[model samples]
Target: MVEALDLALGGVAVGILAWGFERYRTRFVKSDLIIAGALAVGLLIFVVLPGVYDSIGAALNIDGRFVLLSMLAQFVLLAIILHLLSMVRETNARFSDLVRNISADQAPQMDGGERTIFVVIPAYNEGKTITSVVKSLPDTIRGYTLQPVVVSDGSVDDTAENARYNGTVVVEHLVNQGQGGALKTGFQIALEQEADIVVTMDGDGQHPAEELERLVSPVIDDEADYVMGSRYKGENKTGNGVVRESGIRSFTWLINALTKSEITDCTNGFRAIRASGLEDMKLTEERFSAPELIIEARKNGLRIQEIPITIEERQAGETKKPQLMYAIGLTRAILATWIR
Candidate 1:
């Protein structure tokens, strides 16, 4: 007869399998069905014929009891982990949407004349430079009207105030959401205004306003839907040190290998994207989202191109993240973006 523990675990397996089937009729995938089915079958077999693992264990030169326990622990742990991860991801998505909705309402009314190009600058705690960055943008990018929108990601400083004083559109986050979150807010606001193109520039004064036309030109000319400004292809006058430079190259190579595309700079914050094409990608990273954009842009069938751009050192404020944490966060973003 089967033990109590066997019946208890077997019932759970059966329930999960039933749920998987119900989901399959709707949104469940093949992988989910396979895993659920395997668990149910394995548990049922173990309950009905407990000695079945003995011969398998003998062939493997291990104790059957140990094999049974190991499988039991691993299966339960894996199931719980996967379920928790799904819940967390779903929660994060909902929260991000709500935040964007509340914050993006501050987007100034667009006059809806000529080709509207929104220059989105995501800043955090850069009060000393926010006004300067806003004032530095040209009145037009390749003859199209330019609107500057700044997203202050939970800055305790005067970032939002500075942008507002300069009469620039400011989306203020109530809490810190990292660079990725700020970009998402800015993108949503720009799209709501029926923008023709969205150009993202760093608010730290590192990205020159003169190069804005270079990034936006391809989209304006109908040459490419997505254009990434590559520092490697041009000049990195700031000199990001040897170690950081090596790390950037290493990560770029890995991302290129995974994506089957040669991207010179996967971490550049400067890019130009056609408004319609930008709406198709759903970015979820909270930090270091450059890699995510590259992966998603290629995946979404956008005409991706990289152009040479000059980058300078930050004029004010300190780097928000430490070197070690930056590397770890970037790796996490890459893996999450690539797999998800």
Candidate 2:
């Protein structure tokens, strides 16, 4: 009766495994399917040849099938561990490739004539909204020649093409190096072009192009070396959930307390800076660049100001950032920047 019950359970397990494979075949990659298939084959062998286990136990001088089963389990576990190690190695290889693509020769140059305003936009996989972001920029800001430079950070889509279509200069990375790396590249290009003022904004269409003048106003007047946009200070809209909203407020308070700066927004990416001031700023954080840049700027005693701005929902694809991970990274960046 015990043997019969074991066989029945094995049959049921095989049926369930087959059902799962059939139901989710499209969700798995070829390698995943191969692993599942190997497991299924092992299960089939165990179910169809129950007596074979006893034969193997006898050959190995074992008393019962339990020892054989344990050996098989160990083998399967080893296979899984080997697969995971391969995955990790592959991921490391891709990251190394990304780092290799970033050029070391970033020397600022001047165009034929002096240009006053340079807009640096760092984008990754923002094919849907990049065109509009580039097009919405004014031909000239407050009589200063406006030049939009789009840095495509290893985008697999048409982000570079769209920016170029809108008559903006576009630079592309072979692989993604995060937002900080992209912005650094953009800043170097802007400085090379001999821009007096450098403006950084999002490519996701959350930042309005109409506010360009206001964002750069303080820098133009020499009242501040850096102007940070503040959603909390002026008329603005926030589409973030309650948790995100709370996180932003908490981080802003912490940054303010540590930096001794009264800026209402610490993480807002919409901001402007004098090119000359940024010459001394050495940025290193790839993903958490916003906070690091702010902390570094504050430490260097560069004049900082805050102005009211608006942030809206992304116009295209879902946000690439995972909220919890982003907050954690930002927190670490803030602490690291403050200490260093």
Candidate 3:
């Protein structure tokens, strides 16, 4: 017997079909028409075969068939959302690649040196400490000529100008793409200039310029392909208190477990990698890329080592990383890197 629901569904389906036909003929929107038709047909099917869903649900041992329909609808919506997100991510990647190329092209031509090392200091509005950081770097490390590439990642302050005035290589981004994006530009520059070792340090002055050699020593000496400067392994003068410290240790433990590598500090930005090692690694995270780099290096079979290094308090502006955002970003980086 035909029920009230069947009659209502039938009327709705017929109305949708007529409306879709009229809209398609007038507006000529294929997508709209297709969607309207599909939905109308689904409703019509439900109205014609009222007990079909229950029969199929019973066969499949589903407890609630109506709930199954709702879940399927939600799944479709999620799939569409995920597909859109993927497109946005791809677009971002393309834009970042363009910036990196432009930055590398505009970077000052390195002097005629047989071997070179690029110390990439990524800063955003770090004007106060930028100049001092550039001045403190050694002229050479283990005979490799030092090339300080200060990437002012869309800084609105005097960061780029200060570094440029101090006779350091400055790569300025027109838009902020986070530290990872700035470092990626530096890596591109390192590759183009044929650098032997690429050392990455923070521009906020947390990383000591004096310990640069110690950080790059393992990579320079061929002892390891990549090196990380660990505050836990050395002095943590952060003075930001225990919250940050505990978070780092916890994440480090989780990363070590996942990678099966005994890494003391996974969040440390002070790192050195062979130019060739960067070639094998694929890093994507714009903000939380620290773990992404380590994960990629490990995946590519690069021997990784962590050395003791001092991490001082920020010299100027407040920390960009808020606690909640930092935790979420770090977790995202870890899982995304490990799963891939």
**Best model number under lDDT:** 3
> Could you tell me which residue pairs clash in candidate 2?
108-192, 109-192
* Residue lDDT tens for model 3, 149-249: 99999999998888875457888898998999999988988888899999999998999889988888888789999999888889989886689888999
Better of 1 and 3 by TM-score: 3
Error of 1 at 94 (Å): 2.0
Which pairs of residues clash in candidate 1, taking residues 3 or more apart in a chain or in different chains? none
True lDDT of residue 21, candidate 3: 91
Clashes of each: 0, 2, 0
Once model 3 is optimally superposed onto the true structure by TM-score, how far is the C-alpha of residue 114 displaced, in angstroms? 1.9
In order, what lDDT does every prediction score? 0.85, 0.81, 0.86
TM-score of each: 0.80, 0.69, 0.83
Model 2, C-alpha of 168: deviation from truth (Å):
1.1
After superposing candidate 1, which stretches have Cα over 4 Å from the reference? 1-71
Give lDDT tens digits, candidate 1, residues 13-101: 78988977877777757766776787788777777776777767776777865476577669777886998798788898788778877
